[model samples]
Target: MARPKVPRLSADRIADAAIELIDSGAPFGVNALARSLGVTPSSLYNHIDGRDGIIELVRGRLGRRYLPELPTGTWDEIVVETMQGMRRLYAEHPAIVPLLVGKTITDDAVIESYDVLATALVDGGFPDDEVLSVVAVLDSFALGFGLDYASPDDIWQPGTPTRSLGRLIATAERGDARSDRVFELGLELVLDALRLRLARLRDD
Candidate 1:
């Protein structure tokens, strides 16, 4: 009789398994991930730094997929492109978005993306002291919009006790179209403000 072949476990493999579990709406846990990969929970730690490490690996994987390109062009262009990519990635994996916030990003690939953004902002006239604040705002904006992208189309009810909200909801567009419009408009407004700030700094 032939011996059974065993598959090898690696960081990438672990990340893949985690993604599959999350995509299927299964709660992510060390034991669950190991079981999905046909291994024991202890074995996972050998390839990853336990749960937090695995989550970063998963984040890197998703980033490679949706945000593979290094953005070029003007600072606004770089910021816009990177933010759009983040939004798309988080929108696709809405469950993973919350998981990302708690962990300090250690993955080199993920960090590289941020490094690119930081470099671009400095080149675009933002002071070193303010670069991180700008980055945080961009990140927060993307995360919020991404979650919004995943939310229900009919967020507002038709008949509300408050007449004004009901009236406002009536004119709103439904579905991803609505989300897209809002994301674009919000992004434009942010960029406009940044450009204005840069101009003011130049004047000063």
Candidate 2:
């Protein structure tokens, strides 16, 4: 009788399995991941530090795939590009957002992306005290837009005829196009506000 060929298990394999499990809206855990990988729970510890490790691995995978290396450009350009990329990343893996936010980010690649954003804001005249606040605003804005992007095409379904939003929903475009327009408009508003803040800081 031929022996069974067990699939090789590694950190990357663990990460991939965890992502698929999360993407499927399944409850994720070391046992769940190990089962998905056809391995014993103890076997997983050989490659990861357990739950937190798995989360970081998933984050790294998503980051490498969707996050950008902020390019040489104006601060606004850097921010727009970074935010757009972050939104796409989360939009594609909305399930991972909750997992990621619940932990302190320890992934080097993920940290580097923020480092770039921080450097750009600082170089662009934002004070050290305000750098993280700016980053937080951008982070929250991108995550919100990302969740919005993942939402159903029909954002609103008015059961009965009424004024205001119901009427607007009747004619408004649904899906990606509408979401894209709103996201861009929101970005513009944010950027304009940041510019005003920068000007005020310099004047003060």
Top of the candidates by lDDT: 1
Instruction: Report the error of model 1 at residue 71, Å.
Output: 0.6
State in Å the error of residue 21, model 1.
1.2
Instruction: Write the residue-wise lDDT of candidate 1 on 70-147 in tens digits.
Output: 899999999999999999988888888778988899889989999999999999999999999999999999999999
Clash count, candidate 1: 0
Per-residue lDDT of 1-204 in model 2, one digit per residue for the tens?
676597478667788899999999998999998999899999999888989999999988888878645455888998998998999988888998999999999999989889988999999999999999999999999999999977798877878777798878878888999989999999999999999999999999
lDDT of 2: 0.89
At residue 13, give the lDDT of candidate 1: 85
The C-alpha lDDT values of all candidates are: 0.90, 0.89
